[model samples]
Target: MSATGNRAAREFRAEIREWLRAGLTGEYAALRGRGGPGREHEAYPERLAWERHMAAAGWTCIGWPEEYGGRGATLEQQVAFHEEYALADAPARVNHIGEQLLGPTLIAFGTPEQHERFLPPIVAVEELWCQGYSEPDAGSDLSGVRTRAALDGGEWVVNGQKVWTSLAHEADWCFVVARTEPGSVRHAGLSYLLVPMHQPGVEVRPIVQLTGTSEFNEVFFDGARTAAGHVVGAPGDGWRIAMATLGFERGVSTLGQQVGFRRELDALMALARSNGAIGDPLIRDRLVRAWIGLEAMRATALRTMDGVAAGAPGPEASIGKIFWATWHRALGELAMDVRGAASTLTGPGHDLDDWQRLYLFSRSDTIYAGSNEIQRNIIAERVLGLPREPRP
Candidate 1:
């Protein structure tokens, strides 16, 4: 908040803006406005190429310590970078899971050997990561993870299924949460294992979504294996480490996501005007509310970022997950209503246009990462100091 910091932030923002303006042209120009939530399938090879380009330019993992091949950007600087990236319409990043979530977790809890082995590949974009937390039976309640892993020889053999894994098929590694203790239940006796995705025991089946894209997948681990040392933190500490990672999941990148949301809302408002929806009092009111909600979300995200900047996010971070997820879902509804009847029909092959895809994909916005119901529970129990919900 000092004058020096303010000047630095402004300079950083300008530098990022200039870089994006210059770099987004040439081969990457066509990639602008592609590879977001519902559109992860768009220009994937090109996006990977863009990822390597960013790594080379020192733009990837900007929040990580400079010793780890990152910029060691301050929280404000990180926010500025993301906001500028979103404004530039840079392709949605391919390394978000690795860079944002796993990277920080490793920095905090990983051993020196683990850091030396894992951190470089992530910074270099040599290895992609997918989270293995949600299972068919345990979506929001992470403690209910039934996937089991056992040490066999020098490796841990993992066996279970992880559902709704984002980009698992494209990932080289998966950070898996599996039960390591025999007769373990709920949050106990679990281990957070970093498992390789290319081995014979693992299988990835893409789950086609309503938008006709498969950004998420069902990963089956008949006997997936990771080195005994691949476990982050200690055995039975998975719950704590996993909770920290979830906190990271809702960190500064969300500010960037809000920038994207603002752009989407602006487009939706423009659509409403062009389609005469803005002439209607109801549609116009919704658009105004959407804009106001976006501003509020931005403010709240900044307040929350203070905690994220200090260290791994705590329970209060749930506030952000609940707020943004609900807001985005509502925006999707607004997009559909703006489109009116056209939202009902697709061009061909059930192909969805942008608005339609927005509506459909946004439905899961509340569901994934963490569900609204789950988020409310976290806020009530963790943040508000309320009584825990009674389980059946």
Candidate 2:
């Protein structure tokens, strides 16, 4: 970077750092280090308020263009923002699905009317959103979604169930991928529709997790209705748009996520030392390997951002997914080992400690955003020029 660029980057970093220091106070001070991964049930109302506070101050959706209620922050500045937020231990964001995934997807594929209607709320944190892609039968095979939606006069009537939908219970809307054509199958007939969550036809049932929290949910859309104009991109073009949303999912937010990962590893190291787990050569070796893995993840994420900066991330995004998911699951296992006997116990109410919560929550990391098997196939076929897997 040029001297001028370095100066600007430093200024941006300092700006966010100072803002975080000033903002995370009073009621918000207690929100720091709350609400992440398995612990999404913690003080959600407060976190939502904090996010709206951020949006009011022009802090949300910084990567978006200035015309769309964002700061038009460059890739570097956005990275600085997330890094500073995580470093400050600010509350895990409540509107990530809207801000990171759907906002960019709308900017890319939405009509002007849709953009006018949706983007502002996302930027203002007025509405929370959830993704409705996975079904009980589909999980990693998103192409196999059974959720079906058909035009009914001026609206689309949807009927199907979505499983493992994160924050569905709290969302005001959902970006759903459903089959629109009657005879179409697999990737062909899908359409991405933005459906409201507060309707009578939409039922969100929280799926209790091992951590004793219910961030993930089972959402049933029986006769759920969305406006005819709510479909992003053409009716049959949802496969592409959905893939693009997944690409955005692996974008700069992963940098902030890595900061949290580093904090976890650091805390685990301290525990190992205090509890004498560090005396075990195997434990010490795993800790060192975790650190090395985290460094590599960060480097790979920075490299991947170039693709994201240009447009939607390509198949190379799968490499980062596979790397981080495996590393985090392993970190969870290592956390359990670090805690030794205490790992097996819980509080009187069966409440989990941070390490226990980490262990339980990280178990799903590899499975949620495309499984290890699915990511490997993507890397092999798309990134490595391997032949497509034979389909039955």
Candidate 1, overall lDDT?
0.92
Task: Indicate the TM-score of model 2.
Answer: 0.99
- For candidate 1, the TM-score is 0.98
Q: Which candidate ranks first by lDDT, i.e. highest?
A: 2
lDDT of 2 at 209: 89
Q: lDDT per residue, candidate 1, 192-286, as tens digits?
A: 99999999999999999988899999999998788999999999999999988998888889999999999999999888889999999998998
For candidate 2, write residues 122-219 as lDDT tens digits.
99899999999999999898999889999999999999999999999899999999999988988999999999999889998999888888999999
TM-score of each: 0.98, 0.99
lDDT of 2: 0.93
* Count of backbone collisions in candidate 2: 0
Q: Which lDDT value does model 2 have at 42?
A: 92
